[model samples]
Target: MNATNAPDTVFETQRPRLFALAYRLLGSRSEAEDVVQDAWLRWHQTDRAAVRDPEAWLVTATTRLGIDRLRAVRSERIAYPGPWLPEPLTVDESPGPEHRSELAEQVSIAFLAVLERLGPEERAAFLLKEAFDYDYDQIAELLDRTEANCRQMVHRARERLQSGRPRFEVEPARHRELLERFMHAAQRGDRGAITGLLDANARLVSDGGGKARAVIRPLLGGERIARLYWAVARRNGYSDWRMGTLNGEPAVLGYTDGVLTSATVAVSDGEHILELLTLRNPDKLPIPH
Candidate 1:
């Protein structure tokens, strides 16, 4: 078949799946869209007749483009204002018949945040194995590593994830309820209520990026965090803080003088909040005009 005759049909059929893969890898939808567009360009440049597995070819093209862009953008990420959270996913339009339930827990904000802790190669290895369900051989080929090494990387990444012990199985509705209650307590300066909602070992990590005044160190323990919240509420209570959905999960966004100042997303385990992530680095906020 001539390249012009049928590749368009093939591209259209495969584009959505490629997008889902790219988004999960890149953590930024806009960047994923760009990478996919670049992949199409490469696809068009190649001799369609020479290609054996179009899907595999597309995946390789997309992954390489994403990795390249990630390397190029690392400097900008480091300089990002306040706490740099992944771009909030406004909608979950993952392509195809895979239900949200079928998607792995790694797609959650908390999970992605943990993925950010790994080195680039480790992150790539883990995503290819866990999220895409690719075998070690395929992951090695995609990442240009030996199969044994790739397996080791995946094992190490999995160990880190396990150590975090995140509860990705929590229902969104129940999680939202807990977050709302916590936000209300914080807003009202109810130290007792807030303390009750936090785990004894809960920690609050604020990303103020030196622009906004935030607790630099991770605030540990339920009692300490509760007291911190009380002090903050007493001082900044006048600010308009609201509980809302962020990245399809429960979050808190605060505004001062009609300008967005900071936001927080908490990871909970049934009974209490385990990790409280505050993004106050002004550079990190995707301010809407």
Candidate 2:
């Protein structure tokens, strides 16, 4: 390696992990990308030689920046016109630590939505320890908190997130099968078929980001969601349904006249779909014009 280029090389090595941390913390793909870029800038400006541990330095900088970004966006999220779902991210064949381990579940829409309940500092602490596998001491150092405090944060976060997160993991094949069934049922406007596939307490959350048409609030109950799907099929109609993976789980994208309309993914138990998260905001969809 070129001696002068060592710093850049080192930062590049840690970039993927840094990005994974930011994305989980912020939820929005664009916002997470922005935070990572900002972290790079700070790394470039700092005195590299003086930093004894580059990884530790970078992690601290990234966590602080992510916490600040979360605090900054709190009000904007509250005033959001409708429900604010995480921007859909298409996990591809990218070489990164995020693709390995159980990281996918940590980044899922359902999990991230549950994380929204945490305070910025608390969220950072929990994610550092839980998602990234940082030791309690490392997390405490990264967040400038006591070890006991970091433990408390993770414990509190887990408790708060428990009710919203799935208790059991569904097999990948089963998850894909359920998504396929939902797509076919929705397209056919078969209310009974859709209802039968849903759990007793299923809910549907739609996010349009106030840029397009979407529900003002989440629809609760299996029957109500099934009815809404039926109504949507009857009135607007759907074409070119594409099934794929988003955030490491099965998702289906609906398009009309070759223009993307909505992207939906489900949170399922082994037996039933607990919730459906649909992103209709064109700006947030992962597509190129």
Candidate 3:
């Protein structure tokens, strides 16, 4: 398409990619959408004649805006009332084999949680490089750094992330099955029944953004968390629990009275659930009226 090709069309073409990048960088859906909107406004105001590749131009703009937003959010997270978790991306996405192959391993709650440890620059560099398939030269150009500097940032980010996660694989099917059983027990207020599905050192993290009922601290030990789930069910009755794909992984999507209320994702070792992440914050959810 020529420079005069409908600008809105061009922008819409890139919106999904841009939104995904921003969401990964900042871990907030609303913040990411704001960044994408800002990028759109800039695109609208910029000189189209001067822009050769609109995709590249828009990507650079969106990524930079995301970086800035991430910095601000990181500071805000410091004063957050409790442990923060990424806003769950609930999509009824049925990826083709290729999409699944590309993202199945990396896009998970555990992976996103590790990203929170990275500095803003390091995280941006790493995400742009790995997820978007940007080259070092392009990353350097976007960040206004030397190629060597971008490479170093990527290296540091990779090192930090890899230092913790083992080089082993876990089956997504196993994790999905475990969550089904776990949620089933919880829905029945049968807390002890699901104990066998958990790792002995399993952990439960609840993020309610201080606007909902969430544990102020992460619940450690399988028994304690199971009891918590049971108690919630007993008190509130069974939520409309369903399974949905979130960040390329199978997770339990819980709704109350036909509105999305909660989400839970599990990190398993192909055996038992090692970590369960529950996001109950209405702010982070897409609640239907």
Error of 1 at 204 (Å): 2.1
Model 1's alpha-carbon lDDT is 0.75
Which stretches of model 3 miss by more than 4 angstroms? 1-5, 91-106, 164-166, 233-240, 287-289
- lDDT of prediction 2: 0.83
For this target, which candidate reaches the highest TM-score against the unseen true structure?
2
Better model by lDDT, 2 or 3? 2
For candidate 3, give the lDDT of residue 247: 61
Deviation in angstroms for 96 in model 2? 21
Residue-level error in angstroms, candidate 2, position 247: 1.8
> To one decimal, what is the Cα RMSD in angstroms of model 2 from the true structure?
3.2
- On the 0 to 100 scale, the lDDT of residue 168 in model 1 is 56
Please give the clash total of every predicted structure, in order: 4, 0, 0
Q: Rank the candidates by lDDT, best first.
A: 2, 3, 1
List lDDT for all candidates, in order: 0.75, 0.83, 0.81
Query: Model 1 over residues 1-289: C-alpha lDDT tens digits?
Result: 6646688778878998788777777677688889899999998999978999998899888887877877776677677653455654542222112323333344555666676666677877888887789999998898888999999999999898777767456766666677778888998989999999999999887877777888866778999999998998898675577765455455677878877777777888866888888877665566532
